[model samples]
Target: MGWIEKALMRANRWHFVHSYRTIIAREKRKHPQDRERALMGAIGAASRADFAAQGDAQVAVLRHHGLSDGMAVYDLGCGIGRTAQALLRDGWRGRYTGADILPELVDHLRAQCPGFTAIVQRKLAIAAPDATLDMVFHWSVFTHLYPEECFLYLQDIHRALKPGGRLIFSFLEFEDPAHHTVFQTRTANFAVNGWSSVLDSFLHRDWITLWARQIGFAPPRFTSGSDTADHPAFWQSLAVLDKPAPA
Candidate 1:
């Protein structure tokens, strides 16, 4: 299964790259006057409303986990600097490191947002030292990563976080019959970019919890409903996991 999945992923690499180009072209057409919106569209979030909602959710999770000024933060899949922009706009003095897989988008983010550090990272990895980051946030990242990539990224994130550091990520939780078609089609690795399709995805709460434990994290905490969100919206629910401090 592993080898077969790897082969398929390699075959689909072009599709992913083409998808970005296609998005950039379309977003440029749709928001010619607003480059920021166009860039957001290129990163799989073209709609400003949806982008704002997800960014807000990310900030809420950070604050809920005691995020404060001057703390070091690592944002994985930092699409268009949405979370970083929000954090800075709200006066978060924390050192921000925004990393993404897309180089073009990262270039745009770095050019536009000079306050935070941005990098284009490859190979499903975070470029930070062990026990270095105070918090790590991953929004809508796992939805596209293959299972193995997910595990590998989680391992890398675990290595970067300090003891008692908090890791917040969003996933497409397996729920309801509406997702049946996608699940039946893709099983573990499904992705059709720009089709509102949850690609390379499908996860359960227990599966995430088990993986967290195996990655040396404490028990995972799931937050849903209105506990953190200002308004009920179509954003991913957050899972807060912690690393154990010294004995």
Candidate 2:
């Protein structure tokens, strides 16, 4: 890209970030007591209703996977502690670690939810030791990642997870023909810097299972019909993978 194009992209990113900040500020003022609302807006939710539904959907998925109290949990791309907040509200006693790429969101979460640990994860690696975590949930994370990026993170996640550890992550599976048409066109000319544009990357169920198997994980179970997000970035299909423990 030329300097002028680079400058334009920079400006666009700034505008996008600034617009998000403004909406968050407004929501914070409107619902001063509702920290979840503020945090959801800070991350990407457009409205409090959407945030609540999405939170409930995520919690249901966790519960369905047999996640219970006292399990060590990691939330990848844990924007503004949404999953952390959900877990807390459900009375989970897990050791929760929330990691996100945005420093400001991480800092805010560190201050807001002092009980849980939050980190600004610059790399694809999760900050947990090998075979330590009971579960790792990546909400709307793989949606933004390219195939190579997804593979790198999956490798790291496999290293961090314990035997029998569960991995739950979301992706956009192009089941709809209309969506597939657009997804194919965008991915053909995809670029990393255009995350906001090319972030809705699609994945196939067979590919997910293959990737999981390649990384020593059991064949992944793909589920759809999760609650929808107002934002275009959040994917509807979720992949659940389990690390095999020694017999």
Query: What TM-score would every model get versus the actual structure?
Result: 0.80, 0.75
Candidate 2 residue spans exceeding 4 A from truth: 1-39, 176-198, 226-235
By summed lDDT, which 10 consecutive residues of candidate 1 come out lowest?
225-234
TM-score of 1: 0.80
Clashing pairs in 2: none
Q: What digit string (tens of lDDT, one per residue) describes model 1 on residues 1-247?
A: 7999999878676444455566678889999898878888766674888777667766866786789988999999887788877786677897889987778778776876787899877767789989999999888778776777788888998999999898988776656354465556664343444244335476778888899989999999886523434433324656888989999
In candidate 1, residue 225 scores what lDDT?
A: 29
Q: Rate the local accuracy (lDDT) of all candidates.
A: 0.76, 0.76
Measured on C-alpha atoms, candidate 2 has an lDDT of 0.76
Worst 10 residues of 2 by lDDT: 226-235
TM-score of 2: 0.75
Clashes of 1: 1
